[model samples]
Target chain A: MSWITDEMRGIVGKVMREAVSHPIALSDIRKWAMAVYWPEPLPRQYWDEDYAAQFGGIVAPEDFNPFAWMAAKPTPDDPPVSMSAFRESELGVETPDYKAILLTEIRARHGAPMRPGDVIRCVWKISDYMEREGRMGLMLYTTLS
Target chain B: MGDPRTLAVGDEIPAFSREGTVHHWNRFAAVNYEFAGHHWDDDVARHEGFPAPFAMAPLLHAYLHAMLRQWAGPSARIAAVGIRLRSPFLKGCSMTAGGRITAVRTKAGETVAELELWMDDDTGARLSTGTATVAFPS
Candidate 1:
């Protein structure tokens, strides 16, 4: 039996196409942290440059915008049935553009990862969007489901 | 005392590691929605020619994040982190979580630090590698 189901696939497709945004907050970050199988007591150092470079940089929370982030990208013509498609298509929705609707509860674990037959529901809401001014510019606050 | 806060590049961070068993795989499978019948079902995974049920890449990212967060402290915010899955983490296999500081800089008046990270098998085979950036309280 597969873990990813048709209905869930449709839901993922629908979520990807929607023009929505949420504000990023420190608390929201914690919630995401708690949702995962985190080890007790974190390390005492940051991830080196090679790892850090993957994130690129933080998107200004105040300047956060998704439409501009997607910018003329084509929506998935079909529901993604494979992880590669999901990453190449939907995940790219935030690629390059750091601004994204942060999904706090989405956690992956060691296993066959989701299979084709699994069906599940994901509930998310707009968390916060704070405005901050810094020497660089205005920071936008936005998080997503 | 000398600066307890000054961390030079190349300083090693406290590392932690763990191994996943079929139980861990099963637990992960229950929550994940992308498994295609091969995970936790040896018949399925074997029939599909998979050595064993493999861990999800994003989950690997989560584990790495957990390692960094534990180091940064409770109040620290994760500004950004990224990881690339290089090898598979099979059921009943162990992997180590470790990182080292590579650079430190200032941006927007905040001290930003960078780290190099790796998750390896018991033999020290690299499964995933990447970096994390965080801002600590000044």
Candidate 2:
């Protein structure tokens, strides 16, 4: 039997959650660059506005993630749910008891670069799923976008 | 850095290396809001069947981006990046990420390059494989 139930598969292509971020701060971008490139001098474009004057005054890295700790749209009071699980109960189905979840893959597409004071929004959905046989057992890979 | 004009299929980009440590992971966790015990606690990792706490997946993804931006330069656009994790990047291991150009072409008047990407630790374990597309201005 497949690990994904019919109902679980039904939820695919449905929006799981949405969030709007607080304005992106230059500090947020700088700190992120510092953390990711620890011990290495960061590229001048990230922290040195003088050097980045050509990029229209310091654009955030293409991979920079804006929504980290919190979001403006989903305030702290919002019902907290494991986005990975997305509460199978919501589908009126039994939540599968799983040992773990691994972020097996990541795909990011960049548009115009984000800058200081830019507010970003994200909508997540269960894009697809498949099963694979691995060292431990049959693992289910779920795609979220 | 190779000139974007001279870039061609089969060109290997510079690699980015980092020692897998909680000091780095902790900072990334702080910024990304990733606080899973399996990432910072060896006991938790062992409980989860890993020899030591491992690096976060998103960090590995970001490392690839860092490598790309370094090669393509600031003005270049990182059109898209996709990665597949094969093994965990365990703590104390140093991993290096590198990319090789698979295709180079002109799209919409911009120079576009597609690359195959990979990351391996000091132990030679391949942690992840990926693909990326970068577009440079005409």
Candidate 3:
């Protein structure tokens, strides 16, 4: 799908202007964004590869999908209730049932390539979301959440 | 199989640090579609409460991912990563990414490590701080 439609772009432009003055609360936006971005939890098929790489000697760059994890959302066809079940299956654990939306890092850059004053609008949409159970523990899944 | 017990609590993962500049920031913005004029436009940043155009937040996160891969080598699973933004990352400013292991625990027979991270500017002023958990092999 074309991500840059006139309507979408217009909305993005409006948000850019308003973000400074009428900035949406991060939590609120995150909820909506999470609904689309991280619909549920990390899947076992995906997590297993990622888990193996971290604790075991297995390593593959393709195993990690930070962007996918942050941008995916559930489709209309997905059962909302199934999200929980999907997450538990991915972690392979039962306790703690970790459910958190964490913002982990920020790296400031200097001498940016764009002109020093150009305004850029960032518009993110959710692509998929679900839940999964893995080997680690009870994981409340949300790919981007 | 490598003895799972071989892993120790005091093990230190060497911190990987890198310097970033405006050129890098622009590249990140261009890719991420961060057309915010303040990101690369000096006048706009000043008008918008930033000293200069700053790097994109995602770029910062990507850098952290890179740092993790460098330190943990290829075998590292990022269980969860999060960051809270603080000061502006103005253009012409250089940033350094650093972190240290804070705790380690295993759940479901998996070894997970927690680390505290700091993304700072050239003068050592902190721009962001966060904790991340990752599972690594025994």
Number of the predicted model whose lDDT against the real structure is largest = 2
For candidate 3 chain B, the 10 contiguous residues with the lowest summed lDDT are B1-10
What digit string (tens of lDDT, one per residue) describes model 3 on residues B1-138? 112344455555555444455656654443344456766777876665556677666666666655665566434456666666666555666777777677777777677777777788877788887766666665
Q: For residues A33-139, could you state the per-residue lDDT of candidate 1 as single tens digits?
A: 33344333212122232443344422122111122212222323433323221231443333222221212122222221111122223333333334455332443
Give the 10-residue window scoring lowest on summed lDDT in candidate 1 chain B: B26-35
Predict model 3's lDDT versus the native: 0.45
Worst 10 residues of 1 chain A by lDDT: A60-69
lDDT of 1 by residue, B14-72 (tens): 77666666554444334333344554566765654557776655456667766765666
lDDT tens per residue, model 3, A86-116: 2222222222234322222332321221111
Residue A120 local lDDT, model 3: 27
What's the count of clashing pairs in each model shown? 41, 0, 77
Docking class of 2: medium
For residue B28, model 2's alpha carbon misses the true position, in angstroms, by 0.5
Report the C-alpha lDDT of model 2 over B1-138, residue by residue, as the tens digit. Answer: 646789889999998999999998998998888888899997888877789999998889988988998888888889899999999999989999999999989988799999999999999999999999999887
Ranked by TM-score, the better of candidates 1 and 3 is: 1
Contacts from the true interface found in each model, as a fraction, amount to 0.07, 0.79, 0.16
| Colliding pairs, model 2 | none
